[model samples]
Target: MDRQTRSLLAHADHPIAAPLDDDSVGRLLTRAVVRDDARVLDLGCGSAAWLIRALGQRPGVTAAGVDVSAEALERARRAAEEAGVDGRLTLHRGEAAAFEAPHPFEAVLSVGATHAFGGLLPTLDAALRHLAPGGTVLVGDAYWEREPSRWARETLGEYEDLAGTVEKVTAEGWTPVYAHLSTRHELDDYEWNWTGSLSRWALDHPEHPDSAEALRAAARHRDEWLHGYRESFGFVCMALRRTTDT
Candidate 1:
């Protein structure tokens, strides 16, 4: 993640930074191909909710999470302690692409944080580097729901259609296994959650210097989402497996 992303999220009080609905996380885990004591790495893992839940479920699994935000990492550490998995959960504060573990991970999940690697293909390439043989790679990202107007394209930047994304993943030597997509209703909820949470945070922290920035960010999210990009974009969680030895 970039400094701007960390800066924006630093002032916000949301547990999760992105609109990835909580329910979609379970679907991502189900899609992952796990083995006994699977080692997992969560790139740009905010608050470590996914990591804690995964460790709780597998019990035998150990996980690591990387995020550049100190505030987010603090929350993640607290969550791990509360979940009694802190002993097995390692949290690092740095660029996601710079994260290195003692060995390759059996499952690597980067949901809604591909920008950490700059783009889709770059993200996949970095993730593949850390994957064990037959490991799972899960990425949750937004795509064009329809051909956007030029204005919208300029605002949203480059994003592949669902079919194009799948094709590219397959071409990269990953076997597409399963996918979960966010519905229009879920997307609405996700966007609204950010606005609502950030607004309330700004209200409660009026004395904070960054409160105004938080409020402005909330407004920007709402404006861009409702007016500029609404109905034109969709989010998907695609899970793939390494087809060949890494």
Candidate 2:
């Protein structure tokens, strides 16, 4: 998919009317186990909505966001200002993979962003590098179908391990990347938004054959997911606690 965040954000269904992805993000942010002075840096923080909301509502905390897109960075800055969080939040336009905080980070968050990593090592290495001692991490990512649905296996592209990076870090080996958070429950959290967003993408991208196909595949995939995997209450949530050792 294109890296332009506006294009990505424009079509996604948010739990709120604002720029947020869903209520799950807010819940995770609220439950972040951090002290008032804890420093945070959000990776791939598109528009910095998560950072803004967390810093805006929480007191005695400072947060910064990093992203590769200049446009998204600008939006994040503006969002911070609009939310009255400019004093507590900063945004940097840089590649998150290489970005580093000037100070040790008490917390690092990446929601719906780590899918960029196909392997677990790369993701854990990145996360562990930024984490401060005894810090907490909240990791929520896309749910991969136990078996790819018909349309998903066909037109939705490859069946990627969206949650693999988190799993490999915490459960598999290489000194877990922080503690495990509720990954299982968070997977279902995006169903409504994903379905609505993809449907919108299909309707708006009538001329873009690839997008049109992607949206179609998304629709079919959602139906299959609901029938095959979803619950009446929606998603599953995991809680991960970070360890002192690396």
Candidate 3:
């Protein structure tokens, strides 16, 4: 499937595009956006769901988002208009890693988008580039809850354990001010929603040219999650502050 097709199908049910519940998302944004008039930027923002929520929660905040997908950016623009925050929101179509903003932001978010910059640390580096001094960075990425099998490692890429992941961040001169570990229910719900939504789309649109491919992709993804990484994989989102220059 193409990037647009896969993105639309995967996010059909879970608009956040991460294994986070509504409450968790609210809490993380609350912690990250301390300033009422905070300027927030979300790199690899996809459909900019997080930015929309942030803007809604803090009416004084202005936000910007960067993503390579024109389709996703269009959806974000429509959603922002519906939410009545389009006036304060800006959407950019480009690579998040290389996006250049006119000014730095008080909060930079890269949740579930570390892969866009190669890895978690590189994602942080990109966030730092656009972050103001004393600003907060909200980043989310997967880790290994248990020892991963070879298949799991190959499929998901190698990840440190939760503690190691945090240590790496701290060693890079960041302090985790708040953290949320995705619960079992959240993880399983996300997986089910992803596969079920895509499968349903394919089933509902049998005559579409990409329906069969979408179905196969969904099935293959479901299988990979269940047998490849479900038991060992974990996701964590952290609100971090730069403790020292790195």
Model 1 ranges off by over 4 Å: 1-14
Give the per-residue lDDT of model 1 (tens digit) for 113-222.
Answer: 88889887888888888888878988878788888767778877788888987888889888878888788877787677768877877788899887788888789878
Error of 1 at 43 (Å): 1.6
Score candidate 2 by TM-score against the native. 0.67
Steric clash count of candidate 3? 0
lDDT of 2: 0.60
Sort by TM-score, best first.
Answer: 3, 1, 2
Which candidate, 2 or 3, would have the higher lDDT against the true structure? 3
TM-scores, all models, native as reference: 0.91, 0.67, 0.98
Q: Put the candidates in lDDT order, highest first.
A: 3, 1, 2
User: Could you list the CA RMSD of all candidates, in the order they appear?
Assistant: 2.5, 5.6, 0.9
Select the stronger candidate by TM-score from 1 and 3: 3
Candidate with maximal lDDT? 3
lDDT of 3 at 238: 97
Give residue 237's error in model 2 in angstroms. Answer: 6.0
Tell me, by TM-score, which candidate is best: 3
lDDT of 2 by residue, 1-246 (tens): 453743454434552222234555566666663577878777778777778777866778899888777877787787788888898887888777888778767777765555544433454557667888777655544344355555554543343343554455556333333332334444454555666776677687778756766675677767776774443112222334554456
